[model samples]
Target: MKQSGNSKQFAKKDGEACPRGRPREFDTDTVLTSASQVFWNHGYHATSIDDLCKATGLLRGSLYGVFGDKHGIMLAALDHYAEGSVARLAERLNAPVPAEEALRNALLHYARVACALTGERSCFITNTTLEMQPGDEELRTRVAAIQRRMATLLAASVIRGQASGAFNSTLDEKAVGDFLLCVMQGLRVLGRVAHKEDALIGIVDVAMRALV
Candidate 1:
C-alpha cells in the first residue's frame, strides 16, 4: 500500500485567531466578501455581530474599528456586490454579438447560476430589498441604484438589437429592459424550487418573445 497523504499543517487551523499587533492589516475586500456571505445567507436584521466576527475572522472590536459597525460592513458588502454584478452585466451585455444573442447569453448565465448547487440563494439585492424596511434610506438607495444600472445596461443591448433588426424596433428599449429585468429576478426566485432546466428555459423563451 502506497502511503501518500498530504500534510494537514498547510491549512490554517479552524480556530486560529487573527494575528495581533497589526491593525487594518487584513484584506478588506476579502473581509467584505466573507461578511457579505453571512449577511446574504441571513438577512441584516437577523445576522448578529458575532456572526460577522466569526465569518470575517476578526474580533468584534476590530470589526467595529474597521467597518464602524455591522451596518457599515453590510453597506460595504452591498457596494462590493453591486459593483461586481454591474461589471459582469456590462461584460455580458457588451459582448460582440447580435444584441438578441447577447441578451440570451446573459439570461442563460443567470439561469445557470440560479440553478447551480442547491439553488437556495437568490440575488442578495433582491433578498435585502424584501428584508430591509422601507424606511431604510441607504439600503433602498443602493438597491435602487443597482436596479437602475441593470436596466440601463439591458436597454443598451436592446437598442443594439433594434439597430441590427434582430429585435423589434418599435418596442421601447427601456421598457423592454425593465420587462427583462423583472423576468430575470423572477427566474431567480422561481429557481429555488424548480429543478427541471426546461422550465427555466421556457421562461427565458417567453421573456425573449418581448424583444422579438
Candidate 2:
C-alpha cells in the first residue's frame, strides 16, 4: 500500500510556500493500520484522541489536520478494514475448488481467527457494530452495506454450489447466504467468551449443516 507523493518529507522550511507545513511524511496506509488496531482493541467510544495520537505516532494537530476529527479517522479505518475483509472473501469464494467446500473453508477460517487464544483484535467492522449500533447511524449504515457485500459473495458461492449439485437446490440461496452471515457474526461474539476449541468448532460444523 504505497501512498503516492512526490516527496516523503514532512519537515519543510517555514514560509516556503508550502501552506500545509511538512505535508505528512508517514504513509496513510500505515497510519490506518495502526489506528484500526487501537479502535479494534478499544471500542469507538472508549478510544480517545490521545489514544489515536499515540497509536499513529502523529501529534494531535497533525492527526486532526490529516483526518479532520476522530470520526474521520475512524471512518477511514472502518472502510479500510471492510475493504480488505471483502477482498479476502472474494478471493476465498473464487478459489479453484468446490464452491461448497470453499464456502465452508471461508467460514471455518473466520471461526478459527475469531476463536484464537489471543483474539482481542477481532474484526474491526464487527467490533464497530457491536460497540456503536442503534445510535451510530453512519457506522450502522456502513456496516450494513459491508454485510450486504459479504452476503452477496456468499450467495454467489451458494448459487454456484447449487448449480454444481454440491448444495441443496431447494433452499433459497439468498436466505442461506444471509443466514451464514448472521451465524458468522454470532461466532465473532461467541469467540470473545467461548474458552474451549471444540465448542467453537461444533458451532461452525452445525452452521455449515445448513448447506445440506
Candidate 3:
C-alpha cells in the first residue's frame, strides 16, 4: 500500500505501527514555557526537537502540530520569556524605593538569579544573539527590539534618579542606560564561567556607585 504524506506512523505500547491521530490537546502556553526552560538550559543550537518533545511531554507529531517547527516553538518561547522578563523589570522600576536604588537592586537580583541557575550562564535572549545564524534576521531583529526596550526602561530610571538627586547629573541618562545594559550582559557571560555570585554582584555594585 502506498503511504500518504499526511499519514504519519507512530509506535504503540506493544510496538505496533499506528496512524497518528488529530494531534494531542496540548496547551501551547504550557508547552512554550517548558520549551523555554529547555532552551534556557541547553540554548538554541544545542536544543533539538527531540529535546523539546521530552521537555514538553508531547510526542513529535503533537509538537509539530502545535508549534509547526523548532523555530516556531523557539519564537513562542522567546516571546514568553520577553513578556515575563519585561514585566519583572517594570515592577522593579516602579518600586517605591529611590530610582537608583531600585535599579541597583533589580540588577543585583538578576545577577544573583543568573548565577544561581545550574545550567547556563546569562539569559536565553543573550545566548540566542550569540548563536544566531546569518539567516536568522527576524530573530535578530526581535532581540534588538527587546534590548532597546530594556535600555529605554533603564534610561527612564536614570532620568528619574537624576531628578531625585539619587544619581549624578554629570553622566548622560542614555549613556548610563546603555552602560547598564552592557554591564548586565557582561555579568551574564561572566557568571557562565565563574560560579562565584560575588563576582557578578561586584559588577553591579561598581555600576551603582558610578550612577550615584
Off by over 4 Å in 3: 1-23, 119-121
Query: C-alpha displacement of 67 in model 3, angstroms?
Result: 2.7
What is the Å distance of residue 106 in model 2 from its true position?
Answer: 0.8
* Residue-by-residue lDDT tens digits, candidate 2, 16-126: 222453344568888898899999988788899899988987666556656778998998899888888999999998899998789888888778887783556667887
| lDDT on C-alpha atoms for all candidate structures | 0.78, 0.79, 0.78
- Tens-place lDDT per residue, model 3, 1-212, is 11111224233322323345432354667777899989988888889988987898766765655456888888888988898888888899879998977998889987887787653646888888778898898798888888888888999999999999888988898988899889878777777777688888888889999987
Candidate 1 residue-wise lDDT, 1-212, digit = tens: 11111122212322333344222346777888898899889879889999998898766666665567788889889998888889998999889887888899899887876777355357787778778887889888888899999999999999998999999889998898898888888778777677666888888888888677
Q: In angstroms, how far off is 167's CA in candidate 2?
A: 0.9
RMSD of 2: 4.0
Q: What shift in Å separates residue 206 of candidate 3 from its native position after superposition? A: 1.7
Model 3: weakest 10-residue lDDT segment is: 1-10
The whole-model C-alpha lDDT of candidate 2 against the native structure comes to: 0.79
* lDDT comparison, 1 vs 2, better candidate: 2
